[model samples]
Target: MDAYTQPRGKPHVHLVVGGGGLKVTDQAGAEKFGDLPWKTDLDWIRERSEVTVSRLAELFGVTRKAFYGWVEGANPRKGGSQVRIAALRAVLATLPSDLHRTAFFGLVDVNFTGDASFREVFQGPVDDASYQDRLNAKLAEINPEIESTVKRLHRASPSSRAFESEYPSA
Candidate 1:
């Protein structure tokens, strides 16, 4: 089974258990038994565990800002099947005892993994001066406020005045 840990304020682990059905045993009793019904759907959360911030936020009905808050795991994740609950518990066992919101999901390059760029490859090594220059320009071009201010001055709020003047001249 493979496991992964998310990178955030607190960090959480995603565990992949294999080769056996969900098992449960009371701490007082030594005997093991099959998982109870009603926790089956949690398997989906396990299968698709270890997602990125935006992805997790969308999948788990959490706002992006809410995900950023450093609080106890607030997402109402009740168990649908004991198997999934067991799986979740097993995964939780590997994580820090403190399960905060930020710790619940971390950066895993989770959503965008493929070659997102339209071009075939980067023009140069990431650290090179040319690459840095291109990266800076690209970032500026993609920034919403910067782009709006530059190409579409019309989109600027009527109340917004130029920095140099009380009112910006067209």
Candidate 2:
């Protein structure tokens, strides 16, 4: 039988092609790809933001092929660089769950230019300063206090931040 077909009395099998060549694994193993650390985060971001692979690719400045490959168990680092991953995480964190999708679309459409969607707040190819300013502006609309706190933290010295002092050295 072909790799796609299950043999009689056999557990479900799946074929995955990777750097090591073709791999055959049970159904559980196949699904484990979805359980990768970055996959979990990516899934959460996709669900929360109602984003598609195309949109996410644009946001992370990656090609759609790379993005979908990552979703299908390819190395996430191959999909986006470390800096891009960190920026994506930061932008996702700043998004308020309370912000309605319709409202977000309307706001982004009016205030931004060039692919002016909620994705614009997180996606990059632009300078860091411009990206951050856009993100801050979006956050300000959803929750001014959060925006203020973010600015305060950004302006604070590293030594003055709570995380620096919260834990004592062993």
TM-score of each: 0.19, 0.43
TM-score of 2: 0.43
Query: Would you list the clashing residue pairs of candidate 2?
Result: 59-123
Error of 2 at 83 (Å): 4.8
Name the best candidate (by TM-score): 2
Distance from true location, Cα of 10 in model 2, Å: 14
Residue-wise C-alpha lDDT for candidate 2, range 1-170, written one tens digit per residue: 78777556746988988633467879888878557666666666666665567766765667887776666566655423444555555666656552433234334434333435545555545445576666656545555444554556556736555765797667
For model 2, the local distance difference test gives 0.58
Which regions of candidate 1 deviate over 4 angstroms?
A: 1-80, 99-102, 106-109, 112-170
Worst 10 residues of 2 by lDDT: 98-107
Best by lDDT: 2
Candidate 1 residue pairs in backbone clash: 11-103, 38-80, 38-81, 39-80, 39-81, 39-82, 40-81
Off by over 4 Å in 2: 1-15, 18-32, 77-83, 98-170
